[model samples]
Target: MKDCEFFFESKENVEQDGRVILDEYRTHLKDKNTREDINDNELLEKCINIVFEHMKYNRVYIYGIGSSSVVAREFKLRFMRLGLDVDYLAESHSIRMNITRVNQESLVIGISVSGKTEEVIEGLREAKEKGAKTIMLSAARVYEYRSYYDELILIGGLKNLAISDKISPQVPALIVVDILYSHYLNYNNDNKKEKLQMTLEHINYELEE
Candidate 1:
């Protein structure tokens, strides 16, 4: 009961497996619901513009580890479907060895739930040194490595449900993706509709075949 107490924020809530899951769902819902409340539109717009800027001259590179890597690949694919060929760096050397090729035209997105994953942070440092615009996506409200990123996107606000049984980092990271991606379409829906449709059609075809 000591471990489960945090989930029952109010005395009115009782502890059952159903309650445990519903409470967990509420926490997730709280996080997802707050996505719009954070007023990140300005940053979202700035990110899209940075992405758009690179879409023309340079390419987008995604760097992450563990759960962040999953989000990185997903984001890369989402942008790629929009006709922007993106790079998701899965190896340590691939990011560092290629740092020489990164510049202002290049964009490196570093995703770290703790905002303190040393590998992601250090890679972003080198990328920045090479003049690449860097974006840090994390769940932390405040952290020490804030200085390394050109733009900070804090998505999952739920702070300390750190146990393995609890929901994890990738949940909110995807919500950020959903937020940024939905807005991207809204920003240019007229131009993007055909591409979106084509992608859906292709996916449907692949599934059918």
Candidate 2:
């Protein structure tokens, strides 16, 4: 048997090991300093306010590559259900091509955990030059690229685990998305709730069909 066989030697041991892994994951998720940093900086509020300000009168584009692209897609879907005109592009070529569609009445959001995704940065740069408002979500503070975006939202919860490839790179971004979705749902409680319900029902109908 291998040296690590003890973990899977029995069903009970496997369950125990699973629980331990889950516990560790929960610990990482509950990072108090990360939560406090977001709260103190009021970045979540700013993100929500930005969405609210733009969703009404402008088109929104979210750009990301690799894992960050998944979070960008999720954000687009969530905001879509809330009746916002939002879309996401994950491919480098597509992002570059889409820059032309961005204009003064546009809000462009870029996601990059490393804070140095060339494609995302370039996309945001072009969008900004076209007079679109830009927001960059990152875990690292890339001050050099500060001029490229209007808002820089730093996401920190899983710490270096994401950078070290120990966990999903999108976890921190997903947490921010969930918080933003919740605030958006509560913004115009009744109207947004109705929109959400309508979307859910439409999805369910399509699934059943």
Candidate 3:
């Protein structure tokens, strides 16, 4: 079944070993990836604007565990550079215990590939009960966790991709983040550029010490 899909076709001008060509399989996966991202744009933008608006008057929190937690951490790092106060918790129990702090102005993001991580789902549920805005990023189709989420972004199930894409959730997760980063950059390109420069300089100065 996997053999039937093709993301890149050999051009007449190109000649290479099949092994070398196989190494470029990422090119094929990425073509399919772009289409996957296109389907999520409307929801992604809505969620991004919601987050940006919340940041203006409130706070942003992200929760996840395992490799999905890694994605949450990356999301935090990127947005923090834009000067948003973003907090990422890779521990599920911590999020659940502390979620009482979330309110209507708070935007809570839950990142999990399976969308069934007990701790993650529980934490999101708590945030919802507290009246915070919630977003879920997962590779899984909407499931029981959907009830607790205000918005959902399905990353098109990387499992459907070739063998190379099946092992990691980070691939699709990061793709979505890259798009969100672009949205942030586009929303305030000039101001963000200046602030990013200042932040980089400050970090560098601290590191040099």
Best by lDDT: 2
What is residue 75's positional error in candidate 1, in angstroms? 0.7
Across 1-209, the per-residue lDDT of candidate 1 in tens digits comes to 97568656645554555688678758666665355534578988998878777777888888878777888889988877777768887667776776877887889898877776777788888888778888888777545665677888877566552233566767768778877777777775556767766887888844344
Could you give candidate 2's per-residue lDDT for residues 12-36 as a string of tens digits? Answer: 9778868976776677667786666
Tens-digit per-residue lDDT, 1-209, candidate 3: 44433323543224455555455445535666546753666787898788878878777989988888888999999988888889888885687676767888899989877767888788888888888889988777766667799998876564443233434566667778888888877874658877777788978844344
After TM-score superposition, the amount by which residue 48's alpha carbon in candidate 1 deviates from its true location, in angstroms, is 1.8
Q: Report clash pairs, candidate 2.
A: none
What is the lDDT for 50 in model 3?
A: 85
Model 3 stretches with alpha carbons more than 4 Å out? 1-34, 37-39, 160-166, 188-190, 205-209
TM-score (C-alpha) between model 2 and the true structure:
0.84
Index of the highest-TM-score prediction: 2
Q: If scored against the real structure, what TM-score would every candidate get? A: 0.79, 0.84, 0.77
Q: Is candidate 2 or candidate 3 better by TM-score?
A: 2
Error (Å) of candidate 1 at residue 202 is 3.5
TM-score-sorted candidate list, best first: 2, 1, 3
Task: State in Å the error of residue 201, model 1.
Answer: 3.5
